[model samples]
Target: MRMHRIGAAMAAFATFAVFTLATAGAALADTAVKFALDWKFEGPSAPYFVAIDKGYYKAEGLDVTVDTGPGSVAGIGRVAAGTYPLGFFDINSLVKFRDQNPDKAVKAVLMVYDRPPFAIVTVARTGIAKPKDLEGRILGAPAPDGAYAQWKAFVKENGIDAAKVTIENVGFPVREPMLANGDVDAITGFSFSSYFNLQLRGVKPEDIKVMLMADYGLVLYGNAIMVNPEFAAANPEVVARFVRATIKGMQDTVKDPDSAIDSVMKRNETADRATELARLKMAIRDNIATPWVMANGFGAVDPARLAASIDQIAVTYEFTNRPKPEDVFTAEYLPAAADRMLK
Candidate 1:
């Protein structure tokens, strides 16, 4: 009887030890992924922060660390260099990069800014109302700005003489201030960014004239989730999980943008909730939630539209080598269309 009792106790002890180890292993198995964001902690970046704060990333077993980036276009290099496995950037920049450096190119998985906020903002007081108005005027653009990168295309599309406009290389910090002070006749920036910043600086909303490039036939995609092909190829399942988690975060953001801004505030102590909330709402109405996104789905693009954008880009971006459609983006990592429905 004594021997039997000892044997039973040992068996129970072994089972408990095995269970504990198994649980620990599962907890430790989360894949760590580094994501390079287009800019600092801002309202538009709330969804990503929402993912991390709400445990959506953890639900996908992804330990995603979101890092602040210099600009929308620079995140491409960061991902291609393998410093970050994934990043958010303008798809137009990706197309150009794929043409320039085929071997080190990145591909987009999720389209975040479907409406493409590329725009030229000017106050009505400057007498700049149309794309043609930009000619013979002083224009400020940050060298690394996504809107500025497409200036050639904008100039060509609207039949404006590039030589007629005085181009000033304004720092990001001074792009709006220069325009606000009448130093520059116009500036290239994201539609919402320019509008809100100008408003905060005492410019009347009615005086702000925003020319969204997409409304004028740019037809380009804005920022998207891109990945280093090598990293994606090695961990296809992990990539899929990340997309799923991001979709959940985006859905939540659409439901409550203010809450999403809260997540960003936790990361950036100086972020004003009211201002960020306004920015977040504008992004959702203008860029993220759109008629196309509603009719089709989020995170996916119409192939025909993407093809035409590549051709438009070719008009101004003299590529050393032509980039193929598949090289710039792929829908392989996107969740199902049903899963992406924001409504």
Candidate 2:
């Protein structure tokens, strides 16, 4: 009887141990991650969709939920609020957020685009050959801040009187129509994607003039991966894995853009597949193939470039003080996948 009792006790202990281990394993596998997007899922977001379709996140032992939000500010805000772990945001906006809320503890992990995609698109026949010619012309802008301010600053910096230009606030999607119908003489657009869309719509290339923001020293980083510093600090391994998977996704998108487009279309059926595919290809070629993205590495962040961007943002936005460049991003979390591909 004594022997039987002892055996039963041992069996119970073994069962408890097994249960505890299983529960811990399950918890580790169920690490929930939420990624907030600066805008709706489209061509620029192909890599993320590719990652999800390929089970890259699952392979990394992470369960990720991708949520598209209003814009960069809202996306970053949600991440800072601890409601989400990661987000896609503009580097300029991230710097602004860091300056305004130093205690938030958010940092950029990777940059999807090396250069700014913002541009001023005008019909060539309008005779607005340069930024200077924008004087006395109606310019449609996405918002009163950021892109608009930058455009005005660019015009002013180039010796054009911003006061002479009539500014109209138009949303992004409506900007093209406004320009086409002559409601606005010129409009802010993404050079790679928006310009491509116009060309697709039978607008002759020579008839459209695109003054890319990057050409005017408005070289802010766009579509960067950001994470809450607290989460990164607490779960370094998880962060590393996430970055690894993301870089792989980016590489896959670059190598086979068509497949990437298919992946994006599968996930976001509302997007215009042809236009989005064209945009994705253009983004990969124009933005991703730059010296910064190609030489240094994919998703790499340059402190000097970042500092310059912060300065530009401060000047454009008329901020009383600008935050330090180091406050916006950390190179510590960039994955090896990007580094490997660059080599």
lDDT of each: 0.89, 0.77
Residue 125 accuracy (lDDT) in model 2? 64
Best by lDDT: 1
lDDT of 2: 0.77
Candidate 2 error regions (>4 Å): 1-21, 196-206, 336-343
Superpose all Cα atoms of candidate 1 onto the true structure and report the RMSD in Å to 1 decimal: 2.4
Residue 75's lDDT within candidate 1 is 75
- Alpha-carbon RMSD to native, per candidate: 2.4, 2.7
The best candidate by TM-score is 1
Q: Which stretches of candidate 1 lie over 4 Å from their true place?
A: 1-24
Clashing pairs in 2: none
